[model samples]
Target: MSFTTAPSRWSDVWLVTAARGISSCGDFLAASALTLTLQSAGAGGLAVSGLLLAATLPLVALAPLTGRLADRVDSRTLLVLAGLAQAGICVALANTGGPTLMIVLVGLLAVGLAVTQPVLAALIPAMVRPADLARASALQQSAGTLGALAGPALAGVLVGSFGTRLPLLVDAASYLALVAAGLLIRTRRGGGRRPGPVATGAGIEARAWRLRRDPLLLATVIGVAGVVGAVGAINVVEVFFIRETLHSSTTTYGLVTAAWTLGMLAGAWIFARAVARLRRDGALAGAALALLGGCCLMVLVSAAVPSALLLVPIWVVGGLCNGGDNVFGNVLMARRVPEPVRGRAFAVYVGAVQGASMVGYLAGGLLLELLSPRPLVAGAGLAGLAAVAVLAVPLRRAARAERDVRPVSRDEPASAGEDAEPGAGLATPVPGR
Candidate 1:
């Protein structure tokens, strides 16, 4: 997994990363343009919220089917087809003029995105060795962060110069790049197996039941959902906070976002080194929670200070913590979930997080009408800290249990079901089954 080992070992990882970066850039570009277009059309807050919801709600609703497909199909082909579908959706969006039609098109694009996420997540562990998982995750996240950082700024320029249509076209072109990268990826299908029987609703339920039986996995998913929900609230109110509380212009808000993105990049780079040092599961989990708590505290502090200049540093710190948490969380999932069940596990995890975020978004909008942004942001910070405190003991115990269990090597058969004994690590075989 080290750079000195072999270049071929990490080639698929880089290709996946590249594809993700390109895809993310397109997403942000389209998102920014869509927001601007909606605003220009005199769309109200509720309409804007609906548009955002349309873009995210599909992920929550379609998780079960998408996860099953990720497990039963070739991820490479899935990703490529998804990208093509999105490209077509964007083209349809470009042709549409009505707000309702545009919303439907965006929802269709989100469906394509929803399918790609779990497939790509499940494909990652197969792209590299076990020891390289953390580094690879960090690298992939950094790529996506960089794309997010650039996308909006580029969109702003493009929109100002040529209106929203050009940016939409650019986004369509970006998907083609994603398809090309996906085609280049050489990973095995379903982590090295032929397509299994199509997963029925009963089979999906059984897989979900298996996940619930695993204490550590269940805890991780819930904890992540809580944190994401808190963050989502902050996002919903951030623009209002900047404009009303800090008396800042849109440009200042963009600058603050850029600073956060820079911090995320730095944090991802740091994680590439830190993961190797923090080999213990408990320690990594503890470190990640600490960082997340610190991020929440920074938000609280920024709200209290209420200065545009001060917000930049606060957001940078928050972004750093977020980047680290993302890396650790993904690595943890990759380690804990069996390859055969990873698609379902990721599906549950992603669905929970997105559902929580949707709740936060709705709640934030309702709360904003009645309350100030500062208090809401502070509340989010407190909620994140509370989650960390509540989960501390269980997470530590899970870490200790995992520390004693050796991982099943990548060369071993990964087709075995989730038969691992309690506390025997994630990939062990059940005695009789």
Candidate 2:
């Protein structure tokens, strides 16, 4: 039993990072460019927001199928195909004259995104050393944040100066580059052994059924759902909190958002360095508390004080917690779920989080419409606090259980195949199923 050299491991990191960056760039551009394209095509307020809802729907509805596909086939190949599909949709969207056609194209693009994201996540464990999982997750988050910050601004400028259609073209081209980067990657397949008869097809169904019986997974979905909900609420109304609550203008709101983004970037870098000192659950618990505290501070400030001077610190702290929460959640998912079921497990995880987010945004908007910005902001904080309190007991139990569990050594060879062949095949094996 031997290990790969450090140089080989580093190459894998580069491959995964390249793939994520390219994909994030293309995704951001497609979504951003499409918004302007639709507006130009005579979309109204409700119609415009509906396009976003259309995009998010596939992520929730198609997750189980996409998750299964990620585990059952070549993840990199799937990622490449997803990118190509999205590129085609971007072209279709750019040329479309009707609102219906544009909406259809964006929906297809979203479907591609739903499939691509889980496959990209599943690929990380295959590419990096097990001990480096948290660091890898952090790097991925940082890359995504940087891509997101650059991508929309780039797309906006292109859309305004060149034309809305041109940004779509740029997005399509980035997907082409993403495909090329994926081709350059040469990581081991499936991350473990090929699935046995029981672990293959009906096996997938069984796993889904079995997940319903597991209290730990269920509790995790709930706790993480609340965190995601809090994020969604912030996304919808944080700008309003700055403008209305803090009495700042649009430019000031933009600066506050930028500060938040910077905070997230810094937090990711910090987590990559500090991950080794904390157990997986400890990391998640700490992140949850941080998020809870940040929201509490923001709400208190927005409701009681409402000062523009506090906006920078509030958004920065919240954004830092947001980034930490993402890294922690990804690591916990990778560590707790078995390798074979990881895709579906993550899919469920993704769906739960996203679904909760949608609800939170709606709740925030409704609350704001009915009451005031102060109450809405304070409510988010209260929700975060309640989530922490309710989930604390279960979280502790799960953490203890997970700590007692040990991972299979990389040196141990499975009987299904000689070794995991580099670059894709059947599903990986579950460590302790």
Candidate 3:
């Protein structure tokens, strides 16, 4: 489908999202396989969780620097490098039998994954017309969720028979394939990286660094942080909840995670449709309200101890909100931030998200260990609602500003044109799917 708000050449954008999905499937399969591998090797619950956390911590830690790097260099090259690194790490992980080696490999994998996200995010505007940002974001979000749903199931089968090494090998191949695909897709847009400060003599870099002070961006970070916190909390607690409350096994826990992915897929589809019709800002506000309601419902359900059918409803709500939120958030970021600093802005955004998630994971793990899963889950839901409530005013103001700017940007010429308006800068390129 074409959009007046999108570029004339949107087909390329779809290709990127599709490639992303393929890559995600491989990554997830590797992750699932790795988790199982550690479990089968007599890793304790804390150890398995610790391995997962270690892999993610690098992403959080390196996000700011990675973002800065993306702004200074070609995002596609970075993307290719990150993918290759992931492939290499998977290979290392596959060959290793020692838990220490496994942990180290996992940490490397996290660094690769962490660095790729911002670059990928910065690339969206380059692949599509500015007007189509919301649609593209929605599609990407859906692809990711769907990939998550399929990856684990595939990995489970592979690990059940061939053992974990095969899945890691497959993941490595997927990354190599992504690199090939990235190399084939060419664009005139410069990499999202900004020039270095002072010594580097890149005036552009200095200006971008200043954008870190933007109140709108700060608000976005705070809002996203809240959502990330809730997501992490659920991620940490859900398995334990299913195990303890529902008396489920590992397979069932995996299925529950898949259910969440299914919800996210459905949500992304719905959110994309909504954005195509209502525009991103309005659609986002509406979706946020719906999500907040769902969270409230979750709290009630937690108290009541609902049936299996009830669980489906909760999954649907969570998935829909999560998917919608992602699309909306990306649209906002793309629209609001200056293109020159997109890499750093996205990096900051990513770091904030990871930071929130880190806190959430640690807190959730501790809380779950000390208290009941019901309280943790319900508390997160309530906290999500409270977050939405707090951000309502600022979100409204930002949305108004975005709508005001959209028309002016639409009337301007493409950045490649000499006649391009003064404020009409080129979009940043990204490496992530």
Candidate 4:
């Protein structure tokens, strides 16, 4: 478990980054296409919610298994296999009919995502030394943001002209990038890989790493999950809020969404430079929470806007925070979690967020049946802010807990033992578990 990584693999990292972006675009493309297809076919709100559930459920439910799988299996094997499986499923999904069948296919697609997400997340840390983590995290995040920005727009155009089948097929094709990247990228981990410690006597310390055992990490994860749960309902409410209350055109809404993605892309780079200087785990945790609060504050303010056009500027600010917060969380994890179990940690972290988002999505759907969109939007923001406020106590306690521990220089050891302080964790690669 004590093996050091090869010097930062920027070229290999870019291969993974490009592949991730391409696959991510496909994911969004298929999602957008499917949603449009369902709506055009006169599917009810329940059906749409169910579709969303299908797409998300596997990611949350399979974390324990997938996390371990990511740790035990080879990255190249996982990426290539999962990518091929997803592509085949998407191809089938494109030609298939019926809500039930399509829903099942979507769930299967999520199965691939559950496997690959942690693999890529954990791999990025191993791609570079701790000094380059912020840049890598930002680049990876920016890729995802750009994918999000592009996917829906591409889906809109393709689905409008050629129907969902073409767009979905395009999605299937995107998986080829992953397969190529898997074959091309030189740096690899898992399957008893180089950087992670073997489970020998001394390396037991590496495998012993756990999120709950680290209070700062646990608090940060919990706080972020809570905020996500509190605000996730906004995703459901926003369309109705913007169209009905703000009286905006569909084009305006699209632009507003794009603005947020653009903001996040900008924020990822902006915060990458800013947060690298924040060398303490405690500080990174605080900054992430603060940025999340800012994201929600924008959501809350959007509820009061008179026109959807105005939301563009507001969302840009919000998206920036969201993107920046995302980087902080990734960097924080890469720093604290031992390299051996980093994949499992990331899987758990993603499952937590996905689970929280499921609850929020359900709440948004259920609430929309009984409440106005504006109130729900405002309430989502308030709930997120409140969650952050409540989390302050635990975060403060975590900071104090670190006070008694000795500080490790940035160049020192990366042991993840409970006795090791935030500075030591900061010197390490990452801890998402």
The candidate, 2 or 4, that scores higher on TM-score is: 4
Among all candidates shown, the one with the greatest lDDT: 4
lDDT of 4 by residue, 122-153 (tens): 78766776555545655666676788778866
Q: Could you tell me which residue pairs clash in candidate 2?
A: none
Error of 1 at 115 (Å): 1.0
Can you give the lDDT of residue 138 in candidate 3?
54
Poorest lDDT segment (10 consecutive residues) of candidate 3: 424-433
What are the lDDT figures for the candidates, one per model?
0.65, 0.57, 0.59, 0.73
Clashes of each: 0, 0, 11, 11
Q: Which stretches of candidate 1 lie over 4 Å from their true place?
A: 1-11, 39-44, 97-99, 130-136, 191-209, 243-249, 305-307, 391-433
Per-residue lDDT of candidate 1, residues 1-433 (tens digit): 0111223357887887888778778887888677656655665445555667778798889989988888788777887899899999998898888888898899899998788878777666666654455456655676777777777667657766787888898899888866887788887546357432333211232234466665555666666666666656665566567656777654455566566766766765665356545554456567766766767677777778748878777778877776666656655554455566667777777777788777767766677777887888787677767767776767777666755664434343211112110110111000000
TM-score of each: 0.80, 0.74, 0.76, 0.88
lDDT, candidate 3, 46-101, per-residue tens: 55556656766886788778877766677668778888888888888879888778
Model 4: CA > 4 A from native: 1-7, 40-42, 129-134, 194-204, 243-251, 407-433
Q: Sort by TM-score, best first: what order?
A: 4, 1, 3, 2
Better of 1 and 2 by lDDT: 1
Q: What's the TM for model 4?
A: 0.88
